[model samples]
Structure formats: C-alpha cells, structure tokens
Target: MSGHKRFWKAVSVAQENGLFEPRLDGRPIRLPQGKVLAVRSSALAEAIAGEWGQIAEGASFTPDSLPLTRMAGTMIERIAPDPQTTRDMLLGFGVDDGLCYCADGINPVAEQVFAWLSGYGIHPSVTDGLMPVVQPEGYLEAVGQLLATQGDLDLAVLGVLAQATGSLLLSLAVVGGAVSLVDAVLWANNDEKSQLATWGQDDELVRTMENREKDILDAGMFLTLGRQVSI
Candidate 1:
C-alpha cells in the first residue's frame, strides 16, 4: 500500500484495538496516527541508508515492520537542534522558500509563524504579497506551545503527505532514489517544477494544512471576531 494509506490503516487498527485510546481523545484525532507515520517514516529512511551503506540492517524485514513507535524517543533530541535544516527538510526548501509560499498563498498562519521567528531575530521576509497581520497582547507562550506540537505533527505529515501526493520533497527523494547519472539531472529539474507548483488541490496536503489551522486555533491566536490579526 502507499505510505499514506498504510499509515491510516495502522492507525485505524491501533485505534480499534484501543492501543491509542490513552494518549488520544475519544473523538479519534489524527495525532496518534500521525505519530505512527512519523516513526515508520524515519525508520524507513534509516533502513534505506543501511541498504545504501551495505550495513544489512533489517535485511529480512517485510513491509509491515513500520517502526514509527520509536519516534517519541527522538523528539527531545531534535528540539532546538538545527532550525534552518529542519525548516528546509520539512518545507522542501529553506525558510526563505517557505516564506515564498506563505506570500503566494497569503496564508495568515504561516505569516504569523514567520513573524514569531522574526521576533527571535530570524527575520523571515515575504517577497510576493504575504504579510502577517499585527495583533496586540499576543500570546507568545501559547504560540510556543502550539509550535512545539506542530513540530511533531509536521514531521509525520510532511513525509506521508509528500509521498501520497508527489510533493516537491518526494520528488527530491525520488531523485535520491534514482542513483544514476542522467536521471539526476532530469530529477533536479522536475524537483524545481514541483517546488514552484501551486498547492490548492491534493487532499493529503489538506491534512497538514488543517493541522496548521488547528495549531493556530489551539494556540489562541485568533482575535475577538474569530479572525487572525496581523500581529
């Protein structure tokens, strides 16, 4: 099965068996499923490295051996590690590239994220027309909490969504997989196109997009009229 389908299946099974009831809400939230996908994805990536490096890790394992349960162990290890690299890896490019999307999309939430980063001297700017709306008494602490949760969610969603929908990042992975001369050049150009493509469609992409919206909501970032201010 495709990674996204497999991930949802695993989550559905685990939920049915009550394995995820403890850490998740009773309403069947996607967080547990997301976590499972994250660990499985990382383990798969590591296994790929082992394959290329000739290390023989999990040489006999089947496709069912999704090792996503271990991702929680690496959470603390990644926190505050390398912001630039993490942003690039998650967004399929650098912070600047993400900002470009924010501007193009006129995504208020992403603008707020950039604004928050800029407050810490990151100074992420918008080239097209994207700009953060200003607000007063902004809950920086609440924003931090939301960002922490989002950090975890993005790791899971990015890989699965990209794989499901042939996103730019997945194109990069495909290029890495080609492992040949002429294929690399063609793959590079394809990756460029994928990166610059519009993103209004793709159901899987909406999962991550919805998660971002929820993060903003959970962070109490909305103003009195239930609208996001340009804070």
Candidate 2:
C-alpha cells in the first residue's frame, strides 16, 4: 500500500501455530492477498515488525518501506503455491546469466561462481561475446535440482538477488556467503562502470545503481533473518 498513513498504534510479534506473525495494534498483519502473514522464523517476523514500528504515527508510507514483508508475502503466496514454477523461473536466470557472457577475459568472480556451481554438477558454457551460448540439458537439470532443494524463503531471496544483479551466479554466490554483497554489486555493474568511466556519469545510471545496491542488501538481510531459528 503506497501513500497510506500509518494507522496502527503499535507493532509487535505474535506466535501462532508454531509460526511467527507480525502484528499491528495487536492484530496480525495480512498479506496483499488477504492472508495472515506468518513466518517460520521468529527473527524474520521480528524484523518485519520492526519495519512497521519504524513508521512514525500519521506518517505516509509505501510498500517499498516493507521489503521483508513483501518478500515474506511472495514466499507464501507465490513460491509456496507452485514450487516447480518458481524453480523454473529462477533457473531461467542461469540460461542467459551475465557472468557467462563476459566480453573480456574470464572474470575472477565468474570463475569462482562457476567452480561453486560445478560442485552441484552444473557446468554452464562460458563465452567471451554477446552471442547466446546454449547451456547443455544436463547442466540445466543439475541447476534445477539444486534450486529444488532451497526453501521458499531462500528462493525468494535468490529471486531478488538474481533480478538485482542479472546474474544467477552472483545470486548463488551471495546466498552461499562466498561473495560479499558489496563485491557482488561491483561485479554485476562492472560493464556499466567501465562505460561510465569513459562516457562520464549519468544521474539516472547512478540512481539505478543505487537502487540495485539497496535491493541486494535488503535480500541479503532477509535471508539472514529468515534463517535464524525460531525461539
């Protein structure tokens, strides 16, 4: 809900059916689809509640202020409903992953990321040009199997990371803790950075880059909080 006034007097967390629910004024918060928002992780619920709590009374707010809540809703309403579809969507990001089409020599980050995927038996073809390289069926199947193992929340975070960086390799690396968020952003934007260096800064490009950074950081935090054991 964008441009809505903060109507709740207080924000809190409630335990329900062994799940954690963020409450507003003693009532559980509902997703956009009208379902109560319940999460398996207490830490995630608390953090989501904190987002609501931070809004000043009578102040205007937007959904952008509730990144974790949106992600949680996506987990419940989207990923949980049809996991196979979600897995396919995520796996498609790997098909034309930016890391695999570097124009320059092999990227160190790509090398590390490919090695990591290799452990899962997913070996994508890398090329030094813009032409599309068809990844083998075995490679795609392996990646799909790997994605199938991730929980809904993990897939939600991976979706955000993949969209933000346009690189499934970087997304996996970030989720695996093999790459820092800062470095991931840098690696994702290397081409843009090089262009900016030559052609000078564009305000729109800078803003786009900033937004990407925010998205990556938010997803990273969401995954970290969601993984915490409920207590």
Candidate 3:
C-alpha cells in the first residue's frame, strides 16, 4: 500500500531539545543543498510536512508545488545562510513602503491609511504623488526592532512576503500586532483601486489583485501559525 505512494507515505515529527522537524519514512528530510529541515517551531515543521504529504496524494515534485516546504528549504538554504543580505533585502522594502503612495483624487482607503499613520506621526506631502512627506526611517526602525527578535525561518517567511510585495509595512504589521496583512494589502492597493474606479475593472486588474491577495493571504497564514517565531 505505502509502496504505491509516489511520495513518502509516512509523515512524522522529530522532537529534540525544544524543536520539531519533519521525518519522512523515519528519515529526516533534507533541502536540495543537503541541509536538514529542522525548525524551532513544531507547528511550522508539521505544516511543512503537510506540504510534502500532498505529494503522496498526487505526483508532482516541483518546488512551486510545495510552496511552504520550499519556504522551509529557502529559509535553511538561502535566507539563513546570509543574514546580512536577508536583513538588507527585508529592510530594503521600505524604500517604497506601500504607505507612501496616495491617490491623486479620491482614494477610498485614505482614511484607514492616515489613521494608521497618525499613531506614527507621519503626514502626507503633495508634490509628485500624495505621499507620506516623511521618510520611512521610523517605520523601518520599528520593523527592524521586531524582526530582531525572530528566528531565521520566520524571518525568511516574512522576507519572502515582504520582498515579493515590496512593503515592509505589510510584513511588520502582519508579523507584529499592528494590523492584519489583508487590511494592509488592501490599503496598499488603494491606488490600484482608484485606477480601476476611473478605468473600470478588467481581466488584467482582476488577475493582479488575485496574485497580490494570494501573497498577502500566504504571509498572513504563515504568521498565524508561527506564533512561536516571536518566542
């Protein structure tokens, strides 16, 4: 029975010290670069195994197919191995933090956006775009402080989302207790929404929103399961 399965039929957790790892057929799984896929968070490790378990249901072995597992491997192989690059890349998202943009006309999300900014004392400037006049040092510093307390795997997850989305605000809000990533992305996309309102919603716009929504959802889900990342 198990012999017919395309992937490992036996999925398990390896508990040691105070961490957990996924074991396939009683052997620990390794990344493509041969690094063991251990994690400080039991929940995260099990979630990674679940991604692998799906291969048993079907027969594809692409990294994209196993995004979460790929996330673990990425954390171990790429992000973890280079902390300076990772930090630089993560912090680099602030150069165009989503909150900096504003709609020339009526941006529905402006109130919500400014409300979040009020607490941070950022005011808008009107020159090139209706943007936050202030630079993002304060916001980036706050995110850096929170990131300073996380594990590599969690940092990798947030990094993937942050870099992909190009907004440290979303990463920091989702990682910390500031706001939900969904609301954050929605606010970020307010300019897009304004464009759609003026130009009308089309297939291309819909697909763009779909992809962004997926990224935001993925980041939020990872953070939800990753409470121990902060611990």
Choose the strongest candidate by lDDT: 2
**Comparing 2 and 3 on TM-score, the stronger one:** 2
Which of candidates 1 and 2 is the stronger one according to TM-score?
Answer: 2
TM-score per candidate, chains pooled: 0.26, 0.95, 0.74
Q: Candidate 2, which segments miss by more than 4 Å at Cα?
A: none
Lowest summed lDDT across 10 adjacent residues in model 1 is found at 220-229
| Candidate 2 lDDT over residue span 111-198, tens digit each | 7887888788888887887789788878777877888788888899999999999987779878887788878888877877888999
Q: Return the clash pairs for model 3, or none.
A: none
TM-score, candidate 2, is: 0.95
Off by over 4 Å in 3: 1-5, 56-58, 104-154, 191-201, 229-231
Report the Cα lDDT for candidate 1.
0.32
**Worst 10-residue lDDT window, candidate 3:** 122-131
* Model 1, TM vs. native: 0.26
Best by TM-score: 2
Each prediction's whole-model lDDT (CA):
0.32, 0.87, 0.65
Per-residue C-alpha lDDT of model 1 across residues 30-62, encoded as one tens digit per residue: 333343222223333333223223313324433
Residue 225 miss distance in model 2 (angstroms): 0.6
